[model samples]
Target: MELNRFYCGDAIKIMQTFSDNAIHLICADPPYNLGKDYGNTIDRKEWSAYETFTRDWLTQAIRVLRNDGTLYVFMGVRFIARLYAILENDFGLLFNGWITWHYTQGMGRIKGYSPRHEDVLYFTKSKDFTFNLDDIRIPQKYYRERNNMDGANPGDVWQFSHVHYSSKEREEHPTQKPEAVLERMIRASSNPGDIVLDPFVGSGTTCKVARDLGRRWIGIDVNPDYIAMSERRMAQTATLFDSFDPRLKRTPLDLPR
Candidate 1:
């Protein structure tokens, strides 16, 4: 359960190597069916192929997750139904909450309210789940002089700052989630030293937050570019690249960082 892991190849193949009931959390943002080319493939991020890919990894992920653990997934609004169907029937996971995040800019046109939000679904393997509310509370808009309340509990609809296309944090990954967004999720659900697994690591923002918070982490993505970017981000944070053990080798070191 204690490991600093990053796998560079297919998520499904890499996830299989882990044992059952071992992980505390999983936060994944797989391909959004955006139809973008992966350099080698020409098919339109095929849903059938993606579905099978998800099923393969989810099977392993479910087995590796602890009973009271949590699974969080961020999905494009367009693909939520398909993704939810996959999770609901396969895992028997109970729906905990649907978190809505507002992004300042997006791809939609003026015709239909430009899509500016993404959905984050939180589900638990069983009815029993862990929630540390205090870890992610945001402040109230107006200051109250004598209010005994600590901070405003974040509403289901969260308005977080976004990483715009021109920002310095922008990496090679086109669909990278803002780091603040991942920060809140990690804070709300996990503690220092907890294991957080991210199956679609992309530019590794989730892993970066997990490491910054002193959590153990594992991330897997099919792209070598993503894996290398993840390692660099990890390195930039000064998170030691040493695997949890000397003998444990992560999958992306061979690629240039």
Candidate 2:
């Protein structure tokens, strides 16, 4: 279990080698069983099989997480409820918040409402977990005395645009998440020099953000190509994040007269 390295293998198997309570934070974006193509593997599974897969990896994830550690899991609408139950009722992890990643643009559906958001389940191993409020705060919309002028808590609903296909920062991976999302999660949950782990590091967003934020990281992915993709992203430097919360640019109104 070397730090700041990517392992290409089964996530469950790789995590089994990790020492108990070794990871400070885990930001996982596992497959959603939506029949998407991930090059080497298809994101499709039977309902029962997917549930078992989810439980197996999560068991390993929880074992390697420190008592004061935090975990953020990205999942689609289909299985979010089931995931929540497993994390809380089944495993007894401390329920924290259920975040909504609202991407402005997405596939339109004629039969139903267009899908514009995904769910991120946040949990902590214990009540004494790390949470740097100021680290992930967004600017307030109004200049009120009651409000903390420093910044307001970026609430459960997060708004970050998807990396468009033509964007320079976009990777070849099908389900690539924006780096700013990971940036917020890492900043809020873990401190510098802490160990961050991503079991299903699809496009390496978690590892890259962890490295940039000065944390030790371990990324495990089954696809060798994706492992290489993550390596290339780590090597490159960026002046600005690919996406961000729109509220970050807002100016608080109603200044004192």
Candidate 3:
């Protein structure tokens, strides 16, 4: 229940204690039921059980979220559709966008296409939501006098490399997310001093990014090891973040004379 701290417990139970409409942003990366090992827990779950579990935690997330608060959930292809339906129809959360996280490489397949992308669902509790577009804009592809000089919207499809084993930011977790990806989400959805909640904080990417941006954050995970990992990871400060959307580095074209 404490702000800017990591709690080791069930996501739904921990969220139930938070004050209603208190959290300004909720960025959750729950288990994808992929049968992966996560120390004290396994990612696999019975289909019906998984659905119920998702609904329970999401219900609590919606409850603690402010009317203007935004929620971004990272999900795998298998459950993205069902989760979308739950968020849209069951919870009545307004659909903001469906984000595709494109990675350059992934598991290659002999019988089918290689998997290379993940999906994130963005929704808001109400129509009125906080979106600091400038905070998340990427470098424009071309220069035009009519275009906003600050930058351009990164758009729904984003490109961020995976936290591969060779990367320094890579943690022991099987599905660690890129920090820059979470950074963009936090920067766009919440303001300084606002409370950000991540009920299924896997590697603590959300909490760390929020902290660096001056937003208060709460992270919860059932695995004690993961909670510990988050604490250590969030403590370190660096001159630069690990990665960024490639569009941010592209050079804009020269303007007409």
* Candidate 3 colliding pairs: none
Q: Who wins the lDDT comparison?
A: 2
lDDT of 3 by residue, 155-229 (tens): 988888888899878899988888888898998999999999999898888898899999999999999999999
State how far residue 4 of model 2 sits from its true place (Å): 0.7
Winner of 1 and 3 under lDDT? 3
What local distance difference test score does each model get? 0.75, 0.94, 0.90
TM-score of each: 0.84, 0.98, 0.96
User: Model 3 segments beyond 4 Å from truth?
Assistant: 255-257
What is the lDDT, from 0 to 100, of the residue 16 in candidate 3? 85
Which model, 2 or 3, shows the larger TM-score? 2
Pick by TM-score: 1 or 3, better one: 3
Best by TM-score: 2
How would you encode candidate 2's per-residue C-alpha lDDT over 1-65 as one tens digit per residue? Answer: 79989999999999999999999999999999999898887689899999999999999999999
Which 10-residue window in model 3 sums to the lowest lDDT?
238-247
Candidate 1: residue 215 Cα off by (Å): 0.2
How many clashing residue pairs appear in each of the predictions shown? 0, 0, 0
